[model samples]
Structures are given as structure tokens and as C-alpha cells.
Target: MTIKEQYVAAKQAYANWGIDVDAALETLKKVPISIHCWQGDDIGGFEVNKSELSGGIDITGNYPGKATTPEELRMDLEKALSLIPGKHRVNLHAIYAETNGEAVERDQLEPKHFENWLNWAKENGLGLDFNPTLFSHEKAADGLTLSHPNEEIREFWINHCIASRKIGEYFGRELGNPCLTNIWIPDGYKDIPSDRLTPRKRLKESLDRIFTAEVDETCNWDAVESKVFGIGSESYVVGSHEFYLGYALKNNKICLVDTGHYHPTETVSNKISSMLLYSDKLALHVSRPVRWDSDHVVILDDELREIALEIVRNDALNQVIIGLDFFDASINRVAAWTIGTRNMIKALLYALLVPNDHLKELQEKGDFTERLALMEEFKTYPFGAIWDYYCEKMNVPVKERWLTLVKEYEHDVLAKR
Candidate 1:
């Protein structure tokens, strides 16, 4: 049977379960996932003094034809977006700013530094997100940033974050969407630190100073991310989950969660409901971690599906901001973006296709047996047919057809770079 014919069959199957396939597709289309810009250049931004990556963040492998300039990065992103279905946003690091061949300090950044990105995003009909580059800098050499003991270094990082909020606000004002500015610092010690509270206190003070100049929430929203441990911070991290959760609750800011930022066994999916109870909203940096926070390319794994299911089950699509955060240089950069993003969409689509109401009724009635059975049964539903239909509607390649486009672009465009 043809794709549409299969979709019709799947639609009938779902109808028997009281699930509206059409509504699920519509809801999935409306959800916008933010694609990280670092994937194109392997986290090497367009900075004049691009220092070696430090502070617990590192990208492995060296695939050829990585984007070297702001224009090239955007060009690659445009190609990746073409293969992925649905409208999406682009997450940018402050280091990606185009300073027009001039040296620009992180603290001295303004909206004008990203005028090119703003124009590009406007033309593409994409929303923008921002992050302060708190790592891989001269000041961050000690693996400390906002929580640094040096007062001068802490002030410098604080100024950078404050400036990032203004830039985020500018993007939101221009694009008519609220830009999510997230702060994640790799401030911890490789070995044990004697006084952890002192650094955390300094970090809190710095954050307070940064948020003193409040911007309109309509234009830009603030989020603080926490990490259990990082490469050089295995001993202790100041911005643990407990720290940011308290800070977010007290300051009324959004709590950003990175899936790989937690322990190996702990899942961010389980924390959704708990975070929703406290914070007004949540932000997510979705990435796969094999053993540690490796930032591997995301796939449609169990954890990915669970996270998507939680978001949909809680009906928090609007309140939660979802974005991709991974950098794998082992494969084609554009293809990596397309694959990870398509998989993310697939997970959400799978969650949307489930007979959530029916399953809920079973759980409420204490019919655990049927709830378990139905959950397993829904896993084999004809999700691919509906996914193909959605991709067709979105004017993107279905299945593996996107790989062909990426290969062609690599030979014709990226190869030259």
C-alpha cells in the first residue's frame, strides 16, 4: 500500500483506541525544538582568540569540512533544517557572535555582534536562544567561572552573562518570540575543595548581580542549569541540581535541565513533574550520554522516549523549552544535526501517538496489568506511517532520503570549505 493508504489504516487502528491521529500530528508540528549551533562547528565558535576547550566540555573525532565562519555555520544549519520536519529554533553560544573581524570581549558583547544571526533567523522564520560562553576562556583556565574565587574573574563572567540577557532580549523583540538565555558554568574542582560553600556563595552573589538589571519576560526569559559533575569537576560542582533548584525557586527563574548532566542511573524524565511543581517553566538540553556526559548524538532511545512521554503526559509543551545539545565530530556535521533532530521529533511523535487517556484510565482504576500490556502494545503501533505523513506535509525527506541531501551538500558545498 502507499504511504497515505498505510496512514489511513493506522488512523483507523488509532480511532478504535479513541485516539485522534490528526490532532496528535498537529500538536507535534506545533512543538518547536531548538537545534544547537555548536554542532556545525564542533563547539569551536567564531572567536578571535579561540582557546582550547576546557572546563569539563570536550568534543571527540575530527571529521573534515567543519564550518569555520558564521556564514558557513548558518549555511550548514539551513541545510540540516531542510531535512528535518517542523519549525524549530536555533540555540547560539555567545562565542558564535560575528564581530566583523574585530576582537570582542565576552563582557563587551552587544546585540549588534549578532546582527547577522538575527537577520538570518528572521529570514528563516526561526526563533533564537542564547548561552553565555563561560568556558574555554583565559579567565576560566582554573575550571571556575561565575563561582571563581578571584573577584575580578567572577565580575568578568557576571558581566558576560548580563550582556547575554540583553542580546537574548534583542532577539526576542526582533523575532517576536521570547529568547531563552541559559547560564551553565563549569565551576568545580578536579580534586576535592576544602570550602565548597564559599564558592557557591560567591556564585549566588554573582547571579544576583547579573539578574539585578531585569529585562522584560515577554522578550527574554532566564534559566540556570546545574551539573552533578564535569570532566575536571568530578570531585565537586558548585552548581549542583540542589543549588539551581533553590536559586530558581527563590528568584522565579526557569530551571534548565541537561539529560547527561546527572548521574549515570538518574534520568531527567523522572524530574519533570517535580520541577514543574516548583518552577514556572523548564528548559531542556537533550543529549545522549553513554557512560558520562559525553554529549553524543541523540537517538530515539528509551530515555528519549520517556522524556518526551513525560512532557506530553504532563501537557507542558508550552511551559517546557526543548533544545538539542550534542557535538559529535565523528560523522558528517549536517547529517548529525538532521539525524538527532529527526530522532527527537520521532520521540515526541511516538509520545503523541500513544493512547494516553486510555492508559491513564487503566492506572486510575488500579488495572496495572492492562496498563502494562497497553503500554507495551502501543510501542508496536504504526508510528512510522504517521511520521512519514507528517514529514510529507512538512516538505522534508522521509526516512533515509535526507542522508542523500546531506551527502550531496557535502560534496558540493562543505567540501569546498
Candidate 2:
């Protein structure tokens, strides 16, 4: 059957539940998912004196056709963007700065180093986001930054974060959109620590100094992300969720929640509604974590749909900032981004097609039986029909057709590389 014909039938099914499929599609088009740049090159950013990937982060498998240069990475990203629906943003780490073969230290970085990225973003009409690389560096060799015992080491990271915020401000001003400069540090102990308060206190002081540098809020906003544990810091992590949650609330900064940064039983979907109660805005790194904090490619799973439902049902579409964060060297990198991003958008589409208001009313009236039945029945509804129509309307390849183009690019462009 034609895509439009399928959509027409699906629209009527949702309409019976008082759901407006057309309005839902319009809302979905405006949600921009920030695609992480590190996925294209396995987080190996272009730097003159690059350090080994450290701080408990690991990327397995040696995928062929990994982009080796700044231009190539950007080219690969553009390819992935074309396959995904909706206008989106690109997320960058500090190490991705281009300095023309110059050995610019982290603290010495400026906006000029990212001029190429800014120009590419402008020409393509995409928004930009930023993050300070607090891991995989000499200063963080001990697996601690900001919370380091040595004053000199902590000072270096503080300056680097300050420099990164200024660069984020530049992107916001030039692009006419506020850039989210997020900070995620890996500062923890491999074994149980004798004292935790000391490190957290030092970390708090470092953040205060970094924010004191004074960048205009109109151009840039700040966010703090926390992790439960990592490779070396299994026993303890300085930037725990509670630590950053309190800090963000007191400091008036956005608190970022990485889906993979929680415990095995803990779920990010459950925390979204509560976080929204205290703050007007929140940021997310929507990633699939397998077992531990292993950054796996996202899929349309139960948790992903619940997360999307929380955002759409609560009417927090503009309140929550969504971004993708996962890297796998086993598959095609471009295809990895396309699949992960498409699934995220697909989850949002699925949630939008649900009868959220009706479900809530049923719960309010204590009609648990009907609520459970209706939700289950909606699962078998025609969600795929609407998604296929969205792809056709957005002018992207429908269904699995995008993989064909990826194969052609692999043989023609990536094979030579």
C-alpha cells in the first residue's frame, strides 16, 4: 500500500483515542537531537599531542572507514544527518578543535580553533553544542580531575573548562542559538576512599572558579553531568548523581542525565518527571547501556519509549534538551549514527501517538484494568505507518533504503580512506 494511504488509516485509529497524528508529527519535527561527533572517529579527536583513551572509557572493535581528519569527520556526520529525519544539532568535545598542526594545550584553546566547525554549522544551518574533555589527558592520568588532591592538577582542568565555556558562547552568538556547554568529569577512586567529602569539596571549589570566568548566559548555558562509576573508579566517583544534582540546583545550572550513568536497576525514565519539578530545563544524553555503562547503539526498547513518553506526555518537549551519545567500532560508523538517531526519533513518534491524557485520567479514577489494557492494545497500533510517512515527508530514504546509500559510500568514499 502507499505510505500516505497507510498513514490515513493509522491517523483514524489514533483519532479514535482523541490523538491528533498530524499535530504530533508537527511537534516531532521541531525536536532536535544533538548527534555526538565522537561516534564517527571512536572519540579519537584531532589533537597534536594526543593522549591514550583513558578515564575508564573504552571503544572496542577496529571498525574500518573511521574518519581520520576533521574534514572527513564532518563529511561523515553530514551523511548521517541526511538519513535522519528533522533538523538537528551536532555535539562536539574540546579535543575536536582544529589548530592547523599547532600543539595548543587544552587551557589555551580559543574559538578560532573551532572556526571550521562554526562555518560548517552555519552553511548547513545546524545548531552547535559543546563539552569540556575532562578525561583522557595527562592531568587526568590518575583518573581524577577537578577533585584532584594536588592543587596544580585541579587548577589546569578548571582553566580548560573555563576556556571551553567561552568557545561555547562563540558558537551560540554566531549561530543565533544558545549553546549548551556541558561538563562531565571522571574523578573517582579505584578502591574505597578513606574520605569522600574532601574530594567533593575540592570539586565544588573548582567548578565555582570555572563558572566565575563569566561568559554571557544569553549566548551560552552550562550543564553538569554525573556518573555512578567507571572502569578505574568502580569503588567511588566524585561526580555522583547526588553531588551534581545539589550543585546544579544551588548554582542554577542545568543538570544532565546520561541514561547509562545509573545503576543496573535504576532507570532514567523514572527520574525525568521528578527532575522537571525542580528545574525548568534539563538535558539528556540518550544512550543504550548494556550491563554496565558500556555505550551501546540505541534501539527502540521499553526504556527508550518510556523516556520519550515522559517527555511528550508531561509536555516537556521544549523543557528537555535531547542528545545522542554512543559509539561502536564494530559496525559502520555512519550507519551506527543513522540507526541510533532514527530509533530515538521513532520512539518520540510512538509516544506522541499514545493517548496520554486518557491514561492519566484513568489512573486518577483508579481504573487500572482499562488503563493497562488500552496501553497494551496501543502497542499493536499502526506506529510504523506514521513513521514511514514521516520519512517520506521529510524527504529522507524510507525504511531500510538508507543503508543502500551507506553501502555505496563505503565502497566509493570510505574504501579509499
Candidate 3:
């Protein structure tokens, strides 16, 4: 049978086993995935579709960064969105902050900026994730000198809140918005652990203030409170622990788990299970094995990609939003993201083929051993036929484009090492 036929057959089998095949397919289709395309020398302006492989490496050579005029950015985004299908979104960091990383010195979401971004995205049918860091994760531990014990960090964080509100307002003015802000803070320790309690307290305080501001004051307040996620640089990083999440829960925040940020030994499925158990807000960061570094590249079995999908099937968690959190220095950022997303889709399909009855029976009996065994079974189960099937049905051209992307960029990425 053709690949599409195999996919139909496998999906049919899943449906017969009481799985919501249509829902699964829809969720698989609409997972909000994007890459971090920062303003840099490699990519000066924006080449949205072409950068799907290497994250738009050097595509905008000699072009101004965010220093470009608002009209310029709007024009860049307009052209970029027209090339890519669907409402393509990006996770961009705010360049406005005086933090260590590069930031836009321009006003935070000036009226002109918002009007242009809004009109262009609306006209062209696109979206922006606007993932910004409040207290730069890179500086949280070592840059204690830049902040105060209580007052300074609060001030910096609240400033982020103000900036966030302004940006959201600017965007919402154009499109009726959902999820006005995307926050991923590295507010954890790196070395010589500080008073863990203090960090949690400060973070909670900061979030409480932000939430109040967003709900009580902001114009388009449809922010997904649960999409707020944290990552610790190390395993013991403050935000990586349970207490930080507990405090977030107290203030109505959810956990977003990045696959690479967990301790190297932590499997994706286990993390998903733990995060699901403890939190109502669920978001996922998908990336591949980086050996030592986090957010390396995207590979299906590089770590626990298969099992992560199984957790989705077993838990049947539908409210979760899966997004791409890929950062690459040497290779093209967009290419890595596109390949990573496709790999994720392939893994999702494999998870779908695993008989739902088998998974349900194990869960119903409280059979941890049996459930894990079935999950492992699904992890290695062969569904190439099904994968090929969906590729044809969706006209995704998985093999050719995937191979071309991998072949062209994989060597470049490896050579940079």
C-alpha cells in the first residue's frame, strides 16, 4: 500500500481502539511550533521560509538588525509570511532590555511598530510567539551584581511586565489575540546555590504582579497563564525543582517542560508524566540530543522522542501546546526547526499507531510495569508504512524535503564542531 493508505489504515486501527483519531490528527497538525530567529549578523533582516533549516542563518546579510525602521521590519515580515504556509509564528527575544544578550534599543512595541506588525500579519495570515525573557536566564546566577536581593530583581521583572503589556497591546490592536505573552525565564542557580527559598519567593512575587497587571489592566488579556514555563541551567537549578513549580501553582501558573533542559538521565516520557501529574498548565519544548549542551538539534530517537509521544497517548492530554525551542549558533536556525518539527510529527504518528486499548488496559489496572513495557513497545514499533501514508495524504513530501534539509545542513552543523 502507498504511505497514505498505510496511515489511513493505522489511524483507522487507532480509532477502532477508542482513540479520538480526528482529535489526535488535529492536535498533531496545529502544535504551535517555532524557532528563535534572533537579529544577528548572519541573518540581518528576515527570510522566514528559507530559514526553516538553519534558522535563517545570514539570510539578511548587511541588513540592519532591529535597528531597521518599523516599516522595514513590517516589510520584511510581510514578505517572509507570504512564502510560508499557515500562520507562521516565531519565538523572538525582546532586544529592549539592558540585559547581557542582544536587544532592540527601540521603544518596546511603539504604536507605529505594532500597527505595522499587526496589519502585516493580519493581512498575510501569520502569528508571532514573542517569547521574551524577563531576567535573562544567562545572567541570573552570575549577574547577582546587576540586581538587588529583593527590590532590584523585582524592578527589572516588573519592567519586563510593562514591556510585555505594551507589546501585547500593540499586537492585539490588530488581531484578536490569544496568548498575549510567552515567558521562559532561566531564574535558577548555576553555582554555589543561593537561598532557594528566596528565588522562589521572588519569582512568585514577580509572576503575581505580572498576572495582576495582565488581567486587571491589560487590554487583550487572553494570555494562557499555564504556558508560563521555567528551565534550570543545571539539574539543581532553582526553577527545575518541585518547590518553584508549587509556588507557581499557588499563583495560577503552569509548567513548560523543555526536553533538553532536564537532567541528561531524565527521559522525555518520565518528565511529561511528572509535569502532567503536578501541573494544570502544560507546554512542551522539543529539541534533539546535544550530548553536553541543551537544545542541540532535533532527532526522533536521539533521546526519548518516541516515549514522549506515548505519554501523550496514554495521558491523552489535549490541552497541551507543543512549541519548538531551538537555538543554534553555527547552523541555519530555520532548517533545524523544520526538520525538528517534521521529526516530531513522525513520532506523533508512530505514537498514534500503538493500540490504544493496550495502553488503556495497563493504565486502568494500575500496572506501572505493564504500562511502561507497552510504551517501550510503542517506542520501537515499526510504522514507516503509516508515516509514508500521512506524508502523501498531507502532501508533505517528508522524505525528499527532510533528506534535502538534513543532507545540506547536517554536515554544515557538524563541520562547525
Give the whole-model CA lDDT for all candidates, comma-separated: 0.93, 0.96, 0.49
lDDT of 2: 0.96
Report the C-alpha displacement of residue 338, candidate 1, in angstroms.
0.6
- All predictions: root-mean-square deviation over Cα? 0.8, 0.6, 7.5
lDDT of 2 by residue, 47-82 (tens): 999999999999998879999999999999999999
Better of 1 and 2 by lDDT: 2
TM-score of 3: 0.68
**Residue-wise C-alpha lDDT for candidate 1, range 140-215, written one tens digit per residue:** 9989999887899999999999999999999999999999999999999989889989989999999999999888
Question: For model 3, how does the per-residue alpha-carbon lDDT over 90-193 read when each residue is reduced to its tens digit?
Answer: 54445422222334422233334334445555776555445444442322434231123657655665666556666765565555554335554544443456
State the TM-score for model 2: 0.99
TM-scores for all candidates: the values are 0.99, 0.99, 0.68
Poorest 10 consecutive residues by lDDT, candidate 1: 352-361
User: Which candidate ranks first by lDDT, i.e. highest?
Assistant: 2
| lDDT winner between candidates 1 and 3 | 1
